[model samples]
Target: MAIESEVLVIGGGLAGITSALAAADAGADTRLVSYKQSTLRNASGLVDVLGYTPGGDGPVVDPFDAIPSLPDAHPYRTVGVDTVRDAMAFFDTHAPRYQGHHTDANALVPTHGGTVKPTARYPASAAAGLASDDRDTLLVGFETLPDFNADHAAAHLESAGVPFDVHGVTVPFPGDLRAGAKVTRYAGLLDANPRVSVD
Candidate 1:
């Protein structure tokens, strides 16, 4: 048996979902097929445009600036930097309607493992956690949540020479709800109400 759609997006990863949505919004009958629920559930929910300069050392600051330096085979190199910029623009405009927006530059954000990595765009919620030498920060963790480690993240960020004052505190989830789970589980809240808040 076979199904039909103007665009058939295989895999349910971030890229695939975005592609399917874009195609649908453009008036195409798009369909998505995924082997699992979501490829992003375990993800840090960060958007990384470019992490490195091909095989070069260090991370990229302005991804657009580094585009010309990319190899021909790279996705950005093939589609052209303009495409990336346009996509970013799309996210920037539409993201607010879904509780997110495209960040201007790469940011150092923590992961579920309490490690930090550079990413180009991030949700407004996680954007504030970027490693900054200039901004003072207070890191907090939930006692019930085993996924996030405040101490580990603080140590890692401090060792990286984040200039801002850093501190950690523990918080509790409401009522008997100890899930303290990843935000991805509540993704529907965005669709249900843009103004919805997540803790």
Candidate 2:
């Protein structure tokens, strides 16, 4: 048996998925093939347009403004800034769950490692936690997840001079899972039972 498609995307990673979706949206019969799990499954779910430049001293403030500064050999420069902007707009139109700052500027989002990253777009769920927001914020960490230390992250954010008041607390997740369980297991459980209260 054989399958037919007008557009054949060869991978399942972010780029491939985006290509396939774009092709399908353009009225093409697209088919995507992958040999392994998608890299998106392990990603932080942030759409980072440009975090840094090759020899830049700090994170980029505006990805569009910085595009001209990129080296000639860089992919962004090679494709031209207009193409990058069009790609981002295309992504925004298709991905309703993710959003950008609605401008050429980047949003600063805090990571689990106590560092803030500049991104053009992020998951809508993280909108309230942007470092630019001056509201009081609380970070809750799970005891089973050793990689993320909420208290330490809070302190680091304070030291980094974020414009918001932030605090952290560690608590055990409400489940019978072992301490050694992978983060995916916990995420799967939460997905399976959205009403699983911590209290």
Candidate 3:
């Protein structure tokens, strides 16, 4: 088959789709193709600018401030800080309204795992979960769902020794969870089970 466009983007991942849309927005006819699937379907849905470097220390507080300390050939340095800012701006213009801590500070966001990681921008749904000294929170997990570990997460937050209280609860899954089942099935149960969310 023959497909024609001013701009052709290979890969239907997040990057490809964004680039295609951007090109179209810039008045260019764009076409995107992927052999397998978009990587977005397998992503954690968190947007992080930079995490710890190879064998480096803990997560970054202010990614921009730590940029200078990175190797001279780092990708962020190569892209230039302005480019990163522009990308963030473009994303914020879309859905979720990506937000951060202060102007250049990274926000603390919960991961699928038990740990809290730093993200340059996060969805508004996770804003309140950011690490703070005065936010009492509850972490809940499903018994059959392996995506989240409530006990480990709640314990980790408490061990941080912050001035906040953490509680963890393990609840049974509303739907039948089978081996190798997709995570979306679990999420569908939550959306369908009015008793769970409305309580």
Best by TM-score: 2
Off by over 4 Å in 3: 1-5, 53-55, 176-180, 192-199
TM-scores for the candidates: 0.73, 0.89, 0.81
On the 0 to 100 scale, the lDDT of residue 61 in model 3 is 76
Native-structure RMSD, model 2? 2.9
Lowest-sum lDDT 10-residue window in model 2 = 52-61
Quality of model 2 by C-alpha lDDT: 0.87
Could you list the CA RMSD of all candidates, in the order they appear? 5.3, 2.9, 3.7
Q: Which of the two, 1 or 3, has more TM-score?
A: 3
lDDT against true structure, model 3? 0.74
lDDT of 1 at 13: 88
**How well does candidate 1 match the true structure in TM-score terms?**
0.73
- TM-score of structure candidate 2: 0.89
Q: Write candidate 3's Cα lDDT for 1-199 as tens digits.
A: 8554599999888888889879888888888889886768768677888767645765877777776677778888888777878887777766555566346877767665546777887776678887753688888877777767888888887776546788888887666687446777876777678476422
Residue 161, candidate 1: alpha-carbon lDDT: 73
**lDDT rank, highest first?**
2, 3, 1
Per-residue lDDT for 8-55 in model 1, tens only?
A: 999898788889879888888888999968858767666677877778
* Positional deviation of residue 72's Cα in model 2 after best superposition, in angstroms: 1.7
